[model samples]
Target: MEETLHWQPAATHTELLAGPVAEAVRALADDDVHVAAIDPGLADTAAFCEKYGVALDESANCVIVAGKRGGEVRYAACMVLATMRADVNGVIRKRLDVRKSSFAPMAEAVELTGMEYGGITPLGLPADWPILVDSNVASHNRVVIGSGVRRSKLAVSGALLAGLKGAEVLDLATGA
Candidate 1:
């Protein structure tokens, strides 16, 4: 699912991105992506949308999940529309092939991803980690996602996100 989207220069909001995220944005050099700074305190999707005048339907949430197998923990990031929630115990656990899966602790998510708790994005995730994008999310023309920090958000084409390495767009979301 691909659609044309309007994007601008992400470099304009470099100050809002975390170190790794900023570097990743520069590396991509996507003219079809843009970043905008906002109050870190309002980084949460609902607040960010309300405060910044962005529609909730156009905002995506990146949630880190911890899957355990034989005492070893593996992580995956799930991207879904703010209007829905990921099917973690069902679709995700099955996809990950793990015994069980749960949302990663805030500390662990931030530490491992080198991003803020309320601002984790799929863009700069570890290469080994999978980025599960819900089908509906992949079909959106444009979406607002975290910038690896709470102070900013990235506006990008849904097709661009689905194209990221290790990204798998599937039916991973359910009604909230």
Candidate 2:
């Protein structure tokens, strides 16, 4: 866990999390998963890392992407280290079997995931959404990620995240 934030069992700090995130944490019941409060104003990845003295590689970002084919839409979440970028147009598009893919619109992402923009995490996404985790992120011992709210973050092992339902570990990222 990052030293700048006070870490505690995520199961014990549901109040700091968004509704779906809290529910997910309780359901997970994993003691190793932790949470920490932070300044909501610094929720964006770069700002959060710089203000808290955490390295970009020690944090992960969850991105919502929408793929469309034949007028139908498929949505997925891609998890990648902050130092990398999800290959939405290539990897994700092919994975979703869609003709094209791109980052989901902020309004649609927030509404669909029931999370705030800049603070959405894969933990509490819609059950139907596939979670694509970058290989580098899935190999980390611990990484900070959103708690579905701008005011807090979750600390979890990559193994735990990889074990999540609908999670698929793959080469989903490109160099930043």
Name the top lDDT candidate.
2
Model 1's alpha-carbon lDDT is 0.87
User: What digit string (tens of lDDT, one per residue) describes model 2 on residues 69-132?
Assistant: 8998999999999999999888899999999899999999999999999899999899999999
lDDT string for model 1 (1-176, tens) is 22222344886567778888888787888887797767778888887788777778899999999898888898899999999999999999998889999999999999999998899999888989999999888999999999898877889888988998899998999998
CA lDDT, candidate 2, residue 130: 96
Name the runs in model 2 displaced over 4 angstroms: 1-3
lDDT of 2 at 34: 93
Give the alpha-carbon lDDT of every model: 0.87, 0.93
The per-residue C-alpha lDDT of model 2 at residue 26 equals: 91
RMSD of each: 4.6, 1.8
Q: Which ten residues in a row have the lowest lDDT in candidate 2?
A: 1-10
TM-score of 1: 0.92
